[model samples]
Target chain A: MSFEPRIVGFLCNWCSYTGADLAGTARMKYAPNVMTVRVMCSGRVDPAFVLDSFRAGADGVLVCGCHFGDCHYVEGNHKCMRRIAITKRILKGMGIQPERLRLEWVSASEGARFQEVVDSFTEEIRALGPMRLKEWAFIPEQVEAAAAAHGE
Target chain B: MDKVKVTIDGQQIEVDDGSYVLEAAKSLGIEIPTLCYYPYMAPYAACRICCVEAHGVGGWSKIVTACNYPVWDGLEIYTDTPRVINARRTNLEMLMANCAPVPVLHRLAQQLGITEPRWKTDTNYTCILCGLCVRICDEVVGAHALAFINRGAKRDVSTPFQLDSESCILCGACAKNCPTGYIKMEEIENRYIVHKEMNLSPNAAITLPFRQAVPNVPQIVRENCIHYKTGGCMVCAKVCPKDCIDYGDRPKFEEVEVGAVVVATGFDSFDPSPMKQYGYGKYPNVISSEEFEVMNNAAGPTGGKIVMENGEEPRAIAILHCIGSRDHDYHKYCSRVCCMYSLKFSHLVKEKTSAEVYQLYIDMRAFGKGYEEFYERILDEGVNVIRGKGAEVVPSGYRQHEEGHLIVRCEDTLIGKYREIPVDMVILSTALEARQDAKEFGRKLNISTGADGWFIEAHPKLAPVSTTTEGIFLAGACQGAKDIPDSVAQGGAAAAQAMKLMAQGEVMMDAAYAVIDEAFCSGCKMCNDMCPYTAITFDDAKKVSVVNSALCKGCGTCVAACPAGAIMARNFTDEQIYAQIEGMLS
Candidate 1:
């Protein structure tokens, strides 16, 4: 059977979410590995969400928001960028491949982008193979403590 | 603890895993030409300047944006290759022809060894539509003023259809960052016959709050606007210099779907008015740190003259520390700036007017480079350093009715004595407060604010300049109270963050965007027009509108605007949001 990765995508309500809708309306063919979570701003995607997805069996986590300076809420995407940077580092500290997590800035106009990103990130995650429960073994208590420290 | 090995420019380098190409390149001292990349902002790939060639199995060799590209194990990347170089050069040439000035283009042309324009146009504007300035101004500055006005061949950078934009804060950012010289800011003042002082309150025209500001131009405060007030008063237009105050303009609601988001909203200063004990409103002499910055500035009120209300140079100046900060009554956060700025004020006052300077503080925090030494030098100059918290600033009652000379009451905690020191001037170091309308603004953008009112960053320590909003950046005194060094550093950092994103010619977005349940969709086309990033389209053939994921920014305006409730935002579908809401209720 072909490997179907479970990808969790975080879409900002303003642009990315609508772009997906456009893709669907246009019947754009793409991968079905993605399960999207809508956020008001890409900035709202807590690192907890990304890590939580991994904890909940998501093979890849994708975060989408407005183009830079294109946020409906002003600088929310900027905040998301900074957060994702630190999150990637934290994810690396764990046994998780940072490449499994992606942060991108796309506008509502690029439905093809929506299709492409999902296809690409899904492929990347698939290439990385599955997150090993033992390889990523962490004392849940320890991860919780770290998450608390990072204020995730 | 282990470093991952990646090859760039045929050189093997060991960098920590999860490192981006730009970060890895920087570690190896590889200088990549970038325009719209900032570390604080996520990789946007808008400019297509940082394109590099990568060769490997399953490695698509077409140019990929290096800024956003993640470094992988056993990945062979070429930072400089003929195909990649040509693409970059062509992209830059198109940009140059569109926006760069003769000198910058000429120099670049000389370096690239191109003598003439391949696609020559006879236009005077020299700004390449790199979108760096637009992204920086909107995302970093949080002003949403300058943008790419018009599209394609008619695409010119202007404020809402080439009108005098009251929206622009005149931050001079567009001028400061234009790679090409097409967008030169010429300050032209329009004269108006004066008459409305008595009818106006102090806050009436506060929209132009930055008028008489240091970088003197009109900075229209959007929240305090009459349009925002009662949605009335287009007064800014009636009395604008260069007639550059357009109220008829609104932000373009386009959307773009992406795979990831980078939150880089910066910080803002704390306002100290909650402690009415400082008498900020009642005492004309007491001013916040920013106001004092403007006051002491050569271009500030009183024209940089260190004079009291009586129009006399202060014989003795009292500098109060931590008006709204470090006190339990106000913000518990130490405004890392008060001490150094207080000393700076003391020096400026002493140098300009030779006044006796007294610095009253809870504790002298000179933690920066040359700061302790600066404290010692100020002491050597005989500036009185009192270790105590100031109690209050009252009137001396010696001068004219409103011009009563000021007196500072303080408790010298060390000496255990209360000293009502007589002084000609009292400088209140006010706290940097969050914007009053932060919550509403956050709601509009689908982001949240911290309890302290400042836009909360994703990670306080690791991500200092980012907020909870994606594709946006915070800079200057908007995220939190910071010193000059930190603000400037953050500003440049925010710019770099944006550069990284825009540097990618095109961004890949997540598929978690809205998927219209076509049967439910009413074909209203509201989402198509309401999108701020222009990410939606109507398929006449399909008889239903479609959203372009690359263009959709995911603002739920269309979802809310949908009368049929057909347009549902993804990831936050009506079902999921309702489930969460229902769970909360339970």
Candidate 2:
């Protein structure tokens, strides 16, 4: 069977979540690769929740928030922006392609933009293939064999 | 202005007493060439080439310049007399001796049958020193910035002391009137003079709105008018046939009683300066599609030439679509007219100039009839259509010296690679959004506006032209973003709806309204702020919010905001909503 990417999208309640509902109501077709989790606000998301989704075999994680200053709770999306920046670095240190994690902003009225961001991010993750931990784990013997293959 | 009789070449003619003999000769179809005479200015008979023999009533005759000689009663003028012809020939020979063989002089020399001047020819002198430009500058323009310097052998026209004078308004009157084409207006200061106060001014004070207009008459732009500025120059008033030109007339409000109102207030183009990355207001060549449209108009400043601000044709042009349309930060709705107009602009540029055209756009929505075919035709016309939103415009040229260019950055989504194109001009297809005073206008008309500031109609599909207000109707871009065809269709529908209401003498209101159950009511008053139409008001005596039934259309906002479940909309309750949900599930 061909490997289809399973992307977990964390959408906030005020902006990005309503943006997803707008995309559905507008009938704009996008890739059906993402499973959305509706949080109260983007600031309510924990960094540990991101690692848990990756551990649960999700190929990619999408964190969406309100645009800057458009948060329903005033500064909730600003907190999410800072948390996602740190989480991206943590994913990079764990030997996963940092391209698998994306932080986006979609206002309630931008249904077309939400669809575009979803389609493009899905295409990007598809090019990176599956996230297999066995293949990504760095062992000394495999590294030496890869180094010897280059005649180093 | 009094009339007088004068005889020219044995034909008697009546002319204005103060008018010159040249005008009388012109009226009589007698041609007498004069180099120093301009029609709009006072005549300086420096050339003496229009010499004619004037016979007094007492049979005495003498030679005189026909240009400035005033005509009187019983005055006989002979234009072909031998003495008059000899005087004109001698004057032309003396003027040609000092001036080089220019086209104006050569054309006159051919007519007079003069192969060469009798005196030595001086190739060093190109100017004929006729003082036509000097008289036009002093008498007509009222600016004495240019004057003749030195004397006799070294005479020349120049600015005061041959330096840039502060008195020079750069009006180019002297340069335009220079007969020998020796005068040119050079850039002695910051060349790009930005006139901030002018609004879409093609620089002419009086102009037609377009080539084909309803009234098809010229209107004066009072802002840039020289008569209004100096309190002089009543040239238009002097020439008006009906004498209907009134400079004192100003814009005023008019009151009219109407049975119905069609609110067809249109949209305004989104100003791209706030976007910042495209550098619209910062760069010289980065102009919005609205400005580009004006530049492409036949009667525009450059006469429809698609040229840069420097008056040079652009080598390449980049058209960026959806500038503020369909974007999260600016406007979420597409300005439906921009795509077709941008394509038309590309077609015009290709037809007019040999410039390379590039269009960067996201999702070309040519959904209208024959629009897709036009898009296909544009594709066949060699326009490079890149399916991506233009991200930035960076000035990347040393343009002051020569062909400077701007770099347009985009993703090029079809190729899945980031690309930057360098072009001489960038035309931003800006969006058409709601007018700034739309909300206030909606309030004055007792209509409701949506989040995007467009007046909300009764229903998008059924009652597209009807608003919640009974006698008021919506039309064109006032209701939503629409193209010309859709706006015309909706405007016609709105006009018919209004006429129907006017003819019927009444309008039917929506029967559904919200009511508050006083038994379960609390003094919360939160619904007063939540109601979009201001239909709910707090009663100070009862401490409970009351619903104005006459104003309510049962939008159900108070029903959802009521914490105690006090408000119940007519024909729409929680049970009814749940039943509708169940039906949808089925």
Candidate 3:
């Protein structure tokens, strides 16, 4: 495959996850480049998880959550909101495009809004090609081996 | 039948030989004042108010009641004679003495120039003992609910023991036929007598649902029909020239097989009674949009008059919008069609009546073609467009009140001031809500509904009419609140979509589901928590995550979260997505 800008999306189960599903349910067509990963809540997404996706050759990372209030797990989405801000700063220090990381709010009912957010985010990521963090990144094999051993 | 000649007021008239003198006089255009002589029943001349001079054929003359006395050949009947006038006067004076000066008795007394009664009873009563109510109960209705109880002065019309008779059907036939207006019907406990425009029309006992109802037939409201209750009044069947009225017809359920089903069950207008502030059911002239629409209809109970409950033209009319919609406590979703229809109501009210129209709405969503222009037109016509929700409706409680009998309280958001508009009528443009049994109907069709109970479509933009079910479709307000044009377009689209399903005859769904490579799995069980549907389970013996394909929604969340690269989404794998991403960047 030619050089590609792979993007990863971590969507929360209650709000953003259903919101993207609502986009499909609402039939709001948009760019289909971003790969989605669903979690129980936005709090479950770690900053290391965003780093890991980039290490696995993703050019960008998008974290989605419920609107900024007491969310799925009381303050789960709020915690995610604060985490993404720090993650963006860290990406810039690591010689990556800071704009590659984005945090968006998509309620369960805002299907058209989700489509607009996704389309705009995809365009921004496409402008900055492959992350190339993989040039000096930690290997997936090493991380998998460590995780499997820890389970045992 | 042999005809006989008679002289009434020295004018010769002919009639059927055994016909009553009242009929002959009526044929001669002479009106004889009579009571207790209902033509439908045998004339019970309890009140001999139609007395006349009848010179018999044998040269002997006597005074007789014209209502029951028969005319004979050479019979000289004089209705205007002094003797006839005196006799009628005497009979009415006696009735006037017995009963209270009711309007019916007073009108008859005025016709005879009787200033006052010669005698008076010690105790005055309402009933003249005309026996019309009792006769109708016994002879016509056959309900026998009302009977002459006691004797002489103490006699009155009453049901047996007067304690909510089990046999009393509450049919109001006696009340309708009672001429004195003394026999009024009382409301039974649980059964509601529907008002003028609320259910059907005021005359819903027998009416066509509308002038253009398909099958073009009149239906008898069995609940209101007297014949259905007492099995006595076949009046409609008797009077109908075509004799089409059938008391035997009953509703029957029929079933049919179809390739596809279209659910366009429509919507019910939101009832504003639940919001106690509106005072819809608690006050007069506060009407729902549906009731107002019916009232505007030419064939409606008021005959298309935009009048107040007191049967007078309204001075000012207020149209309140969004009764149960777009409110945090009631329904959070916009009803979507209220703003446009409220504008239309203002236009109609302006057209039909000289009443000043006021439109109170939070937001005017005139989002359709010419809808904005229509709003502009109403504004030009001097409709007061207050940008706010109507808060409450109450009686105006003013002194000089031929107009402005009710007051509408609201905050004008545009001007940022509290406003209370006094109006004679308030029309609530209530929201359109999903039918009460929409969920049950959705379940029967294997479809789902959104949180707001609108049927969830497969995709709104692409398949707006198709439901989540394979061959089921949705149209009109059942999907969401929509105006007439939108609903019509959706109805046509739904028909076409259902047609396409029937033509295909079978379904074709995507088979893209996540699968695990047995050699690659490291058995960490990390992917089990990733499935939102709980479709993945770990096989204890194999020590690997197993995905039930039937339950998988193919969202690919588990595939991306898999640590050991064991799980990959089928058809649209990570590698395939990377290829598309490459093309997008290029």
Clashes per candidate (backbone, < 3 Å): 152, 0, 0
Better of 1 and 2 by lDDT: 2
Candidates sorted on TM-score, descending: 3, 2, 1
Worst 10 residues of 2 chain B by lDDT: B191-200
lDDT tens per residue, model 2, B1-586: 7899999999999999998999999999999988878887777888899989999987899999999999998899999987987888888888888888878888887877788778868585778898877776677656666789999889988889999876555555566667776677676686422222234345566766766677977777775564564454456786798996789888799999987889999998899999999999999999999899889888776888999988999989999999889999988888888889889999999999999999998989898999999999999999999999999999876456433789999999998999989899999999988888997787677665656988777656778898755678988998888988889998899999888988887656656567998878897887787665688999889888999987776655567557788887676565554443233222
Point to the candidate with the largest TM-score. 3
Residue B207 shift from truth in candidate 1, angstroms: 15
Cα deviation of B525 in candidate 1 (Å)?
A: 16
**Clashing residue pairs found in predicted model 3:** none
Candidate 2: give the clashing pairs: none
Model 1: how far residue B536 lies from native, Å? 11
> Residues A36-98, candidate 2, lDDT per residue (tens digit)?
876655754556657667766678888888776555444556767787888889988987777
Model 3: DockQ score? 0.06
Docking class of 3: incorrect
TM-score of chain A of 2: 0.86
Ranked by lDDT, the better of candidates 1 and 3 is: 3
lDDT of every model, 2 decimals: 0.71, 0.80, 0.78
Q: In lDDT terms, how accurate is model 1? A: 0.71
What TM-score does candidate 3 get on C-alpha atoms?
0.59
